[model samples]
Target: MTTPQLLMIEDDQRLAQMVVEYLAQSGFAVTHAGDGAGGMAALERQLPDLVILDLMLPDADGLELCRRIRALPGAAGKVPVLMLTAKGDPMDRIIGLELGADDYLPKPFEPRELLARIRAVLRRRGEGGLAGGAEPARGLRFGSLEIDRDARTVTVAGQAAELTSYQFDLLVAMAERAGRVLTRDQIMEAVRGRELEAFDRSIDVHMGRIRAAIEADPKNPKRILTVRGVGYVFAKQQD
Candidate 1:
């Protein structure tokens, strides 16, 4: 079996070398790039199975690079990207997701956790020999929201709704299993490709952002309903 390839784009020399070594030990073939231009050059030649991109690149902005990657012909529907950022602000996280990143990880993180996240993203996209469980066939449509699995696009009232790759994945996970209660861990596993850490409060923040985009009243949140101490449920709409 061919080993999965990863592109590591970061300006931090020590961190980049450490991540490359760690990811190599984790069984992935990693190519390292020091700046955004180098990263883009490498991508233009051959896109990796996944990308580990640092937001604070020297040559160009990481978010802009992500957008460029998304715009690339073969990348629009393939090659998931995991953005790495040092900032932990909720808005920044949301913005990264909104910009088409598959997932975002705050820096000063454990290497093992990073590997887990990489595997999770690849698994969710049906790579790494992990078959996805059953999903809805006809696709899910609720009010102005339409999730087309085949196209991998979400449309709001016939117009494409701008969603980060992670948000889109989260929405699909809930929509397919509407009315089913999903725990925070389950949701994180499904969307971010990582289990929730103890005391991690970011999942709720992401969920709230998702609701604000999809629900008629984010304050009330009819679409994604909270289940008290458990998790959340995607309420099935009846016509």
Candidate 2:
């Protein structure tokens, strides 16, 4: 298997070098870009399998860069992005996901954790299957909401609904087990192959983003229903 190629778009040279070395050791071919513009130029040269984007950049905002990446033509637009945020703020991570980042790690993180996150994101990008081998067939339909597993696409009312790679997987996990109330732990484990972090609202944030894209009214979501203290469930009756 060819090593997965990755692009690191970060302005901090020292930190970027350290991450590059670590990821390279873990069998990734990494290309370093100093800033957003440099990152764009690198993309023009050759698009990597994944992108590690820093939230802060000299030339352009990370969120805007993420939007631009998603706007790129064809498969480039669907390339998975993992964001790095220096603030360690929940809102920052939330915003990153909302802007199309597949996953995020706050700055001053352990290299091992970053590696784990990267693997998880890549796994969701269909580099591999879930705990079980071989995914089900494509086209999971529910009223106006349609999920195409093969294409990794979602649409509501015949309109495409933009979702991060993570969000799409999470939605599939829930929708596959529709009518079942899944706790946060179950949802996290099923979708990410990991335990939920204590006090972490990452799942909630991603859920909100998914609802915004798929629900007719995000304020009052019907398909993905919340079970209050328990967790959430995808309604069996979509129509």
Candidate 2 versus the native: TM-score?
Answer: 0.90
Report how far residue 158 has shifted in candidate 1, in Å.
4.7
9, model 2: CA deviation in Å? 0.2
Question: Relative to the true structure, how large is the alpha-carbon lDDT of every model?
Answer: 0.76, 0.83
Q: Which one wins on lDDT?
A: 2
TM-score winner: 2
Q: Which regions in candidate 1 have their CA more than 4 angstroms from the true location?
A: 71-78, 86-95, 127-138, 143-145, 156-159, 180-186, 189-192, 196-201, 204-233
What TM-score, computed on C-alpha atoms, does each candidate reach?
0.71, 0.90
Clashes of 1: 1
Mind giving the per-residue lDDT tens digits that candidate 1 earns over 1-239?
78999999999999988999888888999999999889889999998889889988878988899899888767763678898999988687767766677777898999988888888777766522112655456567887788777666766668665554456667787776699998887776655455534323556766766776676678988778999999999989732
Residue-pair clashes per candidate, as listed?
A: 1, 0
On a 0 to 1 TM-score scale, where does candidate 1 land against the true structure?
0.71
